[model samples]
Target chain A: MTDISAQDFHDALVAHKLIIPVGVPGAFGRGPVFEDVLRRFGDLVTEAAKNDTAEHMLFPPVIARRVFEKSDYLESFPQLAGTIFSFMGNDTQHREMMNCVHEGKPWGQYQQMTDVVLAPAACYPIYPQLTGTLPENGRLVDVQNWVFRHEPSPEPTRMQSFRIREMVRAGRPEQVADWRDMWLERGLSLLRRLGLPAEPETASDPFFGRGGRMLAANQRMQKLKFEVLVPVLSTAKQTAVCSFNYHQDHFGLLFDIKTADGQVAHTACLGFGLERVTMALFRHHGYVPAEWPAEVRKVLWP
Target chain B: MTDISAQDFHDALVAHKLIIPVGVPGAFGRGPVFEDVLRRFGDLVTEAAKNDTAEHMLFPPVIARRVFEKSDYLESFPQLAGTIFSFMGNDTQHREMMNCVHEGKPWGQYQQMTDVVLAPAACYPIYPQLTGTLPENGRLVDVQNWVFRHEPSPEPTRMQSFRIREMVRAGRPEQVADWRDMWLERGLSLLRRLGLPAEPETASDPFFGRGGRMLAANQRMQKLKFEVLVPVLSTAKQTAVCSFNYHQDHFGLLFDIKTADGQVAHTACLGFGLERVTMALFRHHGYVPAEWPAEVRKVLWP
Candidate 1:
């Protein structure tokens, strides 16, 4: 773990008046300082990706349940998924639900499943959207959106809901892999330029259950996933401020995405967790944005 | 009805390649052009609010279930609420759920209600965050976020999920009401500057069922809600692009927010439905951003 504790970060955020904690764990309302940093970080990322000519896209936080079902997400990480439930009950059932809530009893049973799911990743919606034949050069999309995960931790970096800025590329195998590698270097350099000490290493998703261990091992062995770590809450256990992932043909095959040459498209994405990166910057420099290192301020605010 | 049919607008979007339908009805993945316009719209709103000196805030799209319950949302608009549900099943129940999905059966029964709920409005999260005592000058927050409503329609303006850019103010009743009125005129002027025809009129939220009809009428009669409407989907029934609401200590009583003088804080909020505004812009000034009127283009892009 890092030298700074989660509690320290929390207290610092509260003390600086950068964040207001709701009574619920892991949820917060960010004040101007935090919002300023986050916005500047997003702008910097956008600036860095300017030359890529990636198609900028915005997706709703909640996605169609059918699209999510086709993502094969439930097989790997069911625990992290959130499904939207609605009250389809008649007046009698509604009254019963109210009474149950009034009596401090479970009323969820009265809610029925809706055709929506909270987006598990920033890039999840893009795959199904690219289900048709690609152009001769394939495509790249820049996405920034709120992503949801079920993990509720006191660690400020590990929020249940957070923003991710992602660049997703779909092309031939070599093209996708090369893009991932190029972005990995660029991402590290970019972080360093912003005055943050970041290092990239092979990583794996936090898959669930017995079968997931094998998947994680396979992912690591193939080096399909890499993360840029920064010392946030602890030095020993650095947080992943960014991740580079090569999905290869997994999504293309699922979505029936084919190149102009009629071959299955390969995919890669680089994702920067906005909140974690902001937190890392604050931890490394200071809570005051104006007082941050001159070079860092120049890079971010310029 | 609008001069342009919904079909016509849909065709224009597809023809311009500004949006891609994701098989799910009424849900879409916006492309670069749409994203650009949306971002510019957000910036304009930010610029408009600059003199208001509102603190910029960012909130997670999902909020605590208890906060939602305490907000008395179900009593008025339960039909529009989206509750987050998760599988809290044991191994056997998990297997059963999987089997049910495999067999195309309803498996939501296996899922339990989580501690979170999808935020129905961009301003909803701000109320609970301001629960404690207010500062001497009170507080004003500018929030832009994704919000969910259960209504799914072919009309582009009535999306199940959309972005709401909101400015919420809390203080004495006169302070809140005056701010609302000021913002109302400012919002209308800003939209007019964008070359969109807009008018302000008394409006009400779509409350639920029989009791809700009465509530909506009361809201309209008391002039508690007003909306800035522009003809997008229908000329006869103009769409509400921005809404101004005075909550007259309703949220204060719920969240225990008190002014420095120990009086309950009156709250008011102005919300602009970002997607609807963008839609209105396209409807009024053609779909091509580049070909828009010089004044409008300068106002938005400059």
Candidate 2:
């Protein structure tokens, strides 16, 4: 990864259509730089869509807790998730009793519960909606979602929440795998297009707690996921631009997403973190963004 | 205002690259749609920008709370803002006490106000970041931000929190006026392109208490704020997509942003509610999203 000055990186952002409200934060703490990188990503995803069956889509920033329960998230990955829970009014009233005991005040409110949670992953919604039916031949969905995870700390690359621009396909085994290949290739191509060098390597989600390590190890061993790795802020450990994952029939069995003829759908997804890509660009181009290769600028700006 | 069934609205969305997530509620809470609409609007502003000498710039999401305080927001609109507060070691101490109290008993932990509030608007950052420095030619910057406000009940067009895509320019009197004109025309043109029927009517920000009504009326009388009204589920009152506002020297005085030559930077902004535009699209095409106008589809998807 090349290092660019903060000011130059900022300037390059303004030059490109990569921007959002100055004070707006995506669910997972994405910053302005992420938006700039996403513009480049949107192009890459758009270009990838040219040959894939998927159509681009956007999901709500938040999802209902029931959706997760239906999909079995509470049992599988509860710790890495963030639930949006407002104190139920009854609980608030209970607290009001305590408040009154301490300082004589009656606080009133309505009913509330942990009814919703921010999306934990980009692919959660895909299976639920496509369940019960499958495309005649196959179906591909391109979606960009604000994803959230409950990590204890923040790294520039590993945002507790981030934008996951994904191209997902649910269909016959061959079709889904082929689509993943196309996207993986395209994802690497996009990294190269932006002037970053990346290596495709098996990767794992650093889930939560003790058992998660083994789960991650299993993931890597099975080659369930592949990431486009690029060096950022250092030379040894590289950052990932995109990841390709094959979820054989996991979602299919759970969601019952089946073909028109009634067979479970095979699922594969290509995921990209627009913010990581931007940080990679900053390291590669150095802080003076004006000096960035025209290739990167052209794809991003015009 | 027109009332379209949810299904029909969904259909209209699918018709265009307007693919709504299968189960996520409120696809309208997105900023991308707003960004695109503003892109079209910005094109006009870009043209309008030719009337001035200032260069284009963007901003960051987090603004210091001290800045908000200087602006008198606490005095005028405390209820309307989210003030981010951070947790120090106090929570750890509380957690230990709670654990002791609930030993051998069941109870949830209290972790309220552990973090800073998310930003409430886009403009908050600009005033503070630029307050200390007043450019000679006056500074004109366009900022977009995710804004949050507390509203108990949220409808499709209304949200407790949402994106506020603002195009703001602050500079010397004439220059700010030029920037304002640039965005005004651009905003109007964007509405036309989206094919939504709109009327520029006076508008007012929901100020505190009964004073809000008077301010609302004043907004209408001066035409200081213009709304791009779209009819919605409520036929009698319309939704607002675009708003043009003139702040005169309010922000300049609040933030102390001045020209290099020592004059208050006049300010004006054009705001677009991206979700509202999205809702307007749904209203126009019905939910069978597949049946939406081809041109709009071409622009959004393409």
Candidate 3:
């Protein structure tokens, strides 16, 4: 791997017109080359998981406000949620908001919260849909969705709105654990097959506040989360390209999902950060996909 | 054509689990069959447009606030814009917002407009990026994006957020008009082949207020917009499943786009509402894909 600085790689990608800056931190429009590779990588993932017999589901970026509240996401990552606001006002209110816009004042005051909030994760909505008892095999859903987190940064990988491809499994505890473990191995193998130096390491979610620290530590101790990290940004602080999360009945208990044996189902998910992995590929193999390694080319494009 | 009421059709869809109501007026999660048909139709559109040699660009559902403002969408459709609001505040503000949530009071005040707004159209962001001279053949962009509108209704077709697949062309007036006119025929033919009984009719956008009424009339008089309508929702009122718009120097002037000979470029776009067309298919050819006509199934699935 080329020992290029994160800033240098970002600048190089921007210069090559692979990532177009829209004057917002972590909200850049990906250029054609970046899109092509990202999509091809998505296809590779589909190919890898073709035989899983997972039921495919697609959700919009926004989730219902009630479901958002039900997830307790606000209690955990209060800072990272995106609530949609709209100008649901009368004619007089509209004119007043127009005046504010003309004066360059805050017009957001006139806007009210919509019934939806930007989905913080790909799997949040699926839980509510799986409220009843699952089949004997439980359930496996293949989903790819746009997710939002409010952490704006100059770092290219830390996008505010990004796509995540996930395979969510809901079943008995052993089934969930086995799936998570299988995915941990498969994810690493898949990434390494693409010549990425990916490794699985225990990780924790960025929970909010002092109480969150305890929860994070507990999660780590219980080995609830594992991430496949690659040194895309910097060797000192590798970025998470893939995550394997085992939510032992958290979603089941919340959504009242039940197992075939009439017990609260356990849940687990394997998420591939589409943009981050694409970035890692570009970083490792250089910005040009045509010049990428032959085996990588065959694996992605073929 | 079936003489089912809009409410009846909507109820049928919900009962069949094609669309899952999330307790929101317009926002609903589509079930697996609905998703399957939607994606296959997307593939059909891509197949039909493959020979156009258009550069495919995929944008996120959110657009930069500056670009959104530049589009003057607020001036035209102030009622139909969705703005993203985020909790960008200090710890104290966060606590206050949490208290508001806990008490079920208004907490939207704690949220502020981000640099991005919900993308009102699939092609809005493309114009700003094309702020330069075009080549001899101009530019053609094949874009499929999730778009937002603030109209909330129980009508199954009138989703607040939906996907639109569009082909945008920017060049001389003749070139733009020709592309629009060609797409008008092609879109109609494509829809007809799918047994939609689609027809092209003169149309105008729902521009805002009194001045907007004049503008809308002017648009219809100039024949600037045409919609391919299908009797999906009601027999008396056909729904627009495809739209062909010739924006003669409007986006060009706004974005400073020019032609190869240094003249102002004219722009035109043809958009297919993915959800509307899919709904039309289900309405015309039963809700179940397996029971659909063989020809239609072959066209969509094959």
* By TM-score: ranked, best first: 1, 3, 2
TM-score of chain B of 3: 0.97
**What TM-score would every model get versus the actual structure?**
0.96, 0.72, 0.95
Q: Give the whole-model CA lDDT for all candidates, comma-separated.
A: 0.85, 0.60, 0.86
Q: For model 3, state the Cα shift of residue B143 in Å.
A: 0.8
Chain A TM-score, prediction 1? 0.97
Q: What's the lDDT for candidate 2?
A: 0.60
* Candidate 2 segments exceeding 4 Å error: A1-38, A68-116, A148-155, A172-174, A287-302, B1-116, B145-155, B159-164, B172-197, B207-226, B232-235, B245-256, B261-266, B278-302
Which candidate's TM-score is highest?
1
Considering every candidate listed, which one attains the maximal DockQ? 1
- Candidate 2 lDDT over residue span A100-209, tens digit each: 42442321121122334566677777666676787687777777776665443424465555677876789888888887787777778878877888779989976444
Model 2: per-residue Cα lDDT at residue B203: 76
lDDT of 1 by residue, A1-302 (tens): 34977888888988898877876666677777888888898888877778887887788787888888777787677788889988876667777877877677888888889988889899988898688898987899998888888877888888878999988999988888888888888889988998888999899998777677989999999999999998887778889999998988999999999988999999998899998888888888888988998989888878
RMSD per candidate (Å) reads 1.8, 7.0, 2.0
